[model samples]
Target: MRVLMVSWEFPPVVVGGLGRHVHALSRELAAAGHDVVVLSRAPAGTDADTHPSSDGTVDGVRVLRVAEDPPHLEFGTDMVAWTLAMGHGLLRHALTSLLPGWRPDVVHAHDWLVAHPAIALADVLGVPLVATLHATEAGRHSGWLPGPLNRQVHSTEWWLAQRADEVITCSSAMRAEVSALHDLDAGAIHVVHNGIDLRRWRSRATAPAPAGTGPRLVYFGRLEYEKGVQDLIAALPRIRRRHPGTRLLVAGTGTQQEMLGTRVAEHRVRRSVEFLGHLPDAELTALLRAADAVVLPSRYEPFGIVALEAAAVGATLVASTAGGLGEVVRDGETGLGFEPGDVPGIADAVDRALSDPRAARRRARAARARLRTDFAWPTIAARTAEIYAAARPGPPQNLPRPKIPTGNLFDRTP
Candidate 1:
């Protein structure tokens, strides 16, 4: 089977997990004897050997970086313009035979950023379009499109869903949310859990807690309000009361870092919490391995890729039952769960893990085993390939270029 994947993020220029997700999935698909081609934005000063102007292959998968020229426009306007520019690049590539005897059977898109090119190319090629909604603007904004930017993003997401032949989400929770928001049939959406490379972790030696150090509670992710890191901060004093020697490690940096720092100072738990901003992979893995329990108190999570990483590193999880994190961390089974933004609940969960290290270790072991077998990349790749195979081709009708709405967000007259 031949596959065409469109995404804005890729290797050496990853903004978040989406880039790594595409890189891993494409490589696995290529390894499985399927022809895979990726169309992604080429970052400035991209290495010529790895990311060429016309064509290149990364781990046996062909990758073409669509060059984008900077336009003198507002940030939002430039974003939309760049998206359409990348779409035009894809159009030229599709019309010409750059690769010998290679045509896409399916076009898989990652997010709304690449919707224009992916939908148009799929329609022109008469192939099925499969789109994975990693996260939705509605979900991110707490179940509402609050402003013009939010509404514009939500509109594009809805439009992309309508154009795609099949839609894929990272978890069942996300599928339900998408269905409720878009009024789509529940059966039409498929859930594919995020995966990780365990071998990279298995080779590392588990970092042990420093001599006489207290139980370490680690929170590693974007330090945003929706990420619920503040809830963890608020819960720290209580957690310390239960275990006086408890220490907290806040990893990763975001817009809320300054506010979070202020909260730590106001709470007067400055000595107990260490804000380690942006750790290297080695340091991150070591922290995970050394952590007594990892806390994820996300107010909204389409899927918690970091939860999987913590679990794979044999770290116990005390996560909120928000969106897809619930699917990943079962309450009292794989890991412990609490209500989102419940400071008391987060404190209680952390206390339980610290008090019962033996049980927490058992749960972490169970989680690691599950990740290795159930959420492995090869397994995930095979499942995604099956979805591609199952996607029926659409009519060979060349679609007109998608026009950005000028008035209403949904392109409908009010």
Candidate 2:
């Protein structure tokens, strides 16, 4: 089977988990004896050097990165236009042809960023379009579109749902949310949880951080408001009271760094809290292996890939019981959970993880086993291929692309 995956983010140009998800999935599919081609964007200012096939081979997956002008025009006004430009590049290649005259059996797209071009390109190629909604615009903004940009994005997501032959989401929670938000049948959505590369993490875990007397807690992901890193910070004081000399490591960079840094200063926990901005792969794996517990305090996570990674690296997981995270972290079983903004609850869970290493290790063991059996990429890729097989391809033609509603306008779908 030849699969063409279209996404805006990919390795070395990732904004979040979407790129990693696509990379891992494509690699697994290629390993399973399938021809996998990824159509993605090249980083800014490198268009001259980048080629459609310049990315070379990433674990057997062929990448065709298009070098387009950076979409930095006037507060995201040109985002949709830029996406169309990317789609046009993809469509041109599909028509003129990939190397060796290879064409796609199916077109799989991730998120709304590439939806416009992906749907159009799939139609042109007369191939089945498999749309994976990693997260929805409405879901990200807490059930409201807020402004024009949000509304446009939400509309595109809804349009993708109606346009694609099959829609795949990361979790049951996300499936239900998309269904309710877009007024679509729940049965139309397929729930496929994101996966991690187990061997890679395990190899990087060869040298865990040296053992220290203090309990080391780490949180590595985007430090945004919705991610709830501040909530984890709020819990630190109580956590320290119970377990003296406890230290926290906050990794990743985001808009919330300044605020979080300020909050840390105000709380005067500067010495204990270290903000290591965006760790490299080897360093991240070591940190995860060394940490006593990993905290994921996300207020809105469609699916927590970090949780799966942390669990795979043998870190005791402590996460928020919200969104798809609840499905990932089974309370007192695979890992511990706390309410979205419950500082005290987070503190208690962290204390339990630090205080009882035996039980935490048991849970970590359970999580690692689950990662191998349930969340493995080969299995996930196979399941995704099944969806692609089920979808019937059709020629490119004009379809109903209703104007997406905007600004808290619910209970209506055009």
Candidate 3:
């Protein structure tokens, strides 16, 4: 099967797990004798005027990276306009370069960011449109469209879900969330968990960091409110009380870094915590292998790909029972679990892991064993291919395009 994947992020331009997910899936699909092409944006800071777009091949998969339109639009300030510009660039590139001689049997969209271009391309090609809802806007806000931006994003997600021939989610929890938020039938959504490439995440030959006086815990991911990193900071004092000299290493960056720093000061655990912003894969894997426990305190995770990465490196996990984390980290079986935003619960789980190091290693080993069968990229790719085969391609429907409302009011009409 020929597959065309439309994603806003790809390798070297990844914001989060969505890029990694698409990258791995595309490579695996290509390996399985499928012609795969990814339409994504070029790396940040590329001059769009000089290099409008470029094509390259990575790991046997063809990639077409488009540059943002040369406009005075900023993503942080004008998200909707920036996205529309991106869509326009992608659509123009596809019609002119990609679709003349070559066409895909199906078009797969990664998230709402690429919804416009994906929908337009699929409609023009008369191919099946498969959309993967990595995470929903409503889920991130705890089911409330609080602002105009949030409402607009929600409407775009709903439009994509309604227009898709098949809807794929990373976890069963996300499937239910997308269905409820978009008013789609639960039976129509497919739960396809994010996959990991164990080879890439394998621990290096270098010796792990020497054990310190106290337990060393690591939390790697975006430093956002929804990631619940603040809760992890809140639990630091309690964790230190039980296990003195305990240190927390925070990896990754986001909008909440300054606020998390304030919380660390308020807790007076500044000395015990270190913020290591965005380590490369090699450095991060070494850090995870060295840690006593990897803590994931997510409040609204669609799928915890970090958990899979930590497991691959044989690091014991201490995660919250939030969304996909609960499904990924089984208490006592895979690793330890706590309720979302439960500072005390997080402290307790960490203390337990630190107290019983042998047991934690045993569970870490179990998690590593589970990855080969459960989260393997080839298996995930095969399942996704089945969904593609099941999708029926026909004439495009005259569906309403999602309109980004300028004001508070939204057009709720179907």
Candidate 4:
């Protein structure tokens, strides 16, 4: 089977977890004896997209990168619009004009950023399209959004999901949300769950979860509002009352870092909290392993890839039960769960993991076993490949190229 995947992000030049996910899936698909190609947006000099500028290959998977020339677009001057236009042009130029002769059976796209190109290319090439909705606006909003913009984003999401021949989401909870929110048929949405490369992660876990000589509790991911970083911050003072020297390691960066820093200062748990900022994969795995427990207090999540990573690193987890995190981290068996906004609940769960070494070990074992078996790359790759084959009927039709404009090659208003 020939597979073409479109994603806004890919590894080595990652903006978030999406990049790693796309990269992992593509490599896995290649390993499964399929011709896999990934279409992503990257800087011209980025490692995944070296000198040739337009297209390249990594680990047997063809990667096409469109260097976003921000100054070129004639549309809205807003940053978001410019980004959307850049991505749209990249897809049109790469798929329709530059890579005309190239066609594949499956067009697998991840998230809305790649929607315009994936949908258009699938139609132009007469290929089936599969969509992976990593997260939704509602999920990201944590039930706060209201009015026109929210509705517009929601409607766009539904249209994109409806366009796909198959829908793949990261968690069982996400599947349910898609079915309910987007009016998708229950049979159409499948739960693949995000996977981690255990060999890379577990090896780094040799550092152990940082338990301040005894046990460490960690909350590592993007430092932002929707991420519930505030709740985690609030929980710290209460937690310190129970267990002094119970250090909290907060990893990753975001727009709210300064604001979060202010909150951390207010609590003055500054000494108790270790703001490690952004950690590389090796460092992250080591941190997760060094800690007694891992925590993701997201108000909403499509799937907690970090939770999967923590589990892979053999760390017990305490996560918000709002989204797919609940599905992956079993409440009592693998990890503990807490209400989304409940600071005390989250704090208590963290404290439990810190104090109960035996229970934490058991949870770690359960999490590790589950991640190794169900969410391993090979298993996930096989499942995704099956979706690709199911969506792709056969050889693509010999499609005619769009008449490129004398000026901008990506002008596809027709």
Candidate 5:
């Protein structure tokens, strides 16, 4: 099968887990002898004409990175305009470079960022469209479309879900969220969990800590509010009182970094918490392996890929039973679990891990073992292929553009 995957982020241009997900899936599909091509954006400041857009073949998968159109639009301030420009560039590239020579059996879109181009390409090619909703705007805001921008994003997500021939989500929780938010039949949404590559994340031997060193807890991901990092900070003081010499190492960057730092100072646990900012993969893997416990305190995780990373490195996990984290970490069987935003719960879970070194190691070993059967990339890719095979092609037809409702119904009256 020939597959064309549309994603905003890929490989060296990764912004988050979505890029890693697409990279791994595309490689696995290509390795299985399916022709896979990924359409992604080039890195910032690349000369569009000079830099070769097509990276011939990467791990058996062809990658076409398109440059953003010449515009002074900044994504931070003008997201909708920036996205529209990106979509225009992608559509133009597809029409000129791909159509005459190669065509895809199905067009797979990763998220809302590339929705416009994906929808347009699928319609033009007359192929089945497959969309994966990594996370919903409503879910991020805890089910409230508070502002105009939020409503716009939610409407786009609804349109994408409605237009796709089949929809895929990373977790059962996300499937339900997408169905409810978009008013789509729950049966139309498929749950395909994210996967990990064990080869790259194997456990490494770490040098032993000095006799008086504290227990190191590591949190390596974005520091956004929804990630519950501040809650982890709030729990630190309580954790230290129970077990002195319990220090936390935070390694990530986000808009909430400054606010989290302020909270750390307010809690008076400043000395115990060290902000390491963003560390590269090598440093991060070493940190995860050496840590006493790797904490993931997400409040709205679609699927916690970081849990798999921690498991692969044989690190004991202390995670919140929120969204997909509940599915990944089996309470006592895999690692300790806590409720999201529960400061006491976080402290208690960490205390349990520290109190029993043997039990923590045992659970960590179980988590590592489960990876071979449950979170393997090949198994995930095969399941995804089934979805593709089941997708039926249909003729392209015009669908009404999604409308965002203003508070006043008569605002548009002349």
Candidate 6:
């Protein structure tokens, strides 16, 4: 099977997990003897004025990165405009011409942002369109104010989900959320948990950090609203008191940087909390190797890949029990689980990592071993391919697309 995947982002130009997720999934599919082509927008090419194919291979997957102008709209954030313009650039060549040439058997889109383009591709190519809704607006903006942009995104997502032959979600939690939000039957949605790459996250049982020093507790990801890093920061004052030297490494960049930095300053634990902004994979692996535990304070995560990566890297894992994280982290086993807003509980989980060194190491080792066997790219991609083969052509009829100006949308379908 040939799969053309449309997504807004792809590494090393990733803003979040979606790009890496698509990258891994596509690679897996390619390894399984499927021809997979991933279309994305990024700015790394010799030709500045043209869309660069990037004509390279990643774990058997072929990636063609299209170059486009900065997606800066007047009324919306870059995120909003990028979503729509990501698709707009693809139509430089007519969809009618592009689809037949690519000759894809399946048009698989990664999220709502790419729905329009994917639907358009599937329609033009006469192939099955499989829409994967990694996260929904309701889940993303549950506690925050959802603007017109979010509503428009959901409307387009609803249309694609209903029209596509199948909708792939990250977990049962997400499946339920999507079903309710789109008013679709739960059975129509398939739950495929995100997988981690063990090769990149491995720690060869390295030597520990200074003994008796407060253990290193790390959190790596975007400092976005849904990440709940603020909650973890709030719990830090308590964690610091129990273990004076316990270090907290917050890796990743976002709008929340100033607020989180101020949090450390206010708590007078500026020394304790190290804001290691946007670390490279080498740095991430080193930190995971040194850390006693990794914490994910996501308020809304479809699947916490960072927690999985931490486990794969031999870092004891603890994450909020919100959303699909429960499916990945087993309490008192592979990794610990805490309630979303429970600051005390968050502190307690971190304290447990600091106090029980041997047990934590054992759990980390176990989780790392599990990830090696279970989360390989080829395995995950093969399953994705199965979903594509089983899917039929066309989205279900009568699905509604909420209105948002195309100016702010990522038009997945040209």
TM-score, candidate 4, is 0.86
Candidate 5: Cα lDDT at 183: 75
Deviation in angstroms for 255 in model 6? 1.1
RMSD score of candidate 6 (Å) = 5.1
What tens digits encode model 6's per-residue C-alpha lDDT throughout 1-414? Answer: 988888877887776788889988888777678888877766532233565545466778777666665434432346566656667665443354345576888888888777767777787677898888988876777622247666666777778777888889988888888786766799878888788876775545443354356667888999887888888888888887887777788889988898888877877777778787887677678887787778998888888888777876677888898888877887888878899878899999888877888888877877777776666666777778789889878533554444343332212211
* TM-score against native, each model: 0.90, 0.91, 0.94, 0.86, 0.94, 0.88
Which ten-residue region of model 3 has the weakest summed lDDT?
Answer: 405-414
Name every residue pair that clashes in candidate 3.
Answer: none
Please give the CA lDDT of all the candidate structures. Answer: 0.83, 0.83, 0.88, 0.76, 0.87, 0.75
In TM-score terms, candidate 3 sits at 0.94
Candidate 1 lDDT, tens digit per residue, 1-414?
Answer: 989998888887687889989999999999999999988866743433544466789999988876554443333456666566666666666557443567788999999988888887887778899999999887776765666677677777887877788999999988987776665787999999889987666637555455446788899998878899888989999988888888888889888999999999989988888888998787889988888899999999999999899987888999999999998998888899999989999999988888898999888888888887878999999999999989996664444433443333322311
Clashing pairs in 2: none
What is the per-residue lDDT of model 3 for residues 31-139, given as tens digits with 9 covering 90 to 100? Answer: 9999999999875455578666898999999999998777777778999998998899888988888889788999999999999999999888889999999998877
- Writing each residue's lDDT as its tens digit, candidate 5 over 246-364 gives 88899999999999989999999888888888876777788899899999988889999999999999999999988888999999999999988898999999999999999999999
**Model 1 residue 295 lDDT score:** 94
Candidate 5: count of backbone clashes, pairs at least 3 residues apart or interchain: 0
Check candidate 5 and list the clashing pairs: none
| CA lDDT, candidate 4, residue 337 | 92
lDDT of 2 at 48: 38
Worst 10 residues of 6 by lDDT: 405-414
lDDT of 3: 0.88
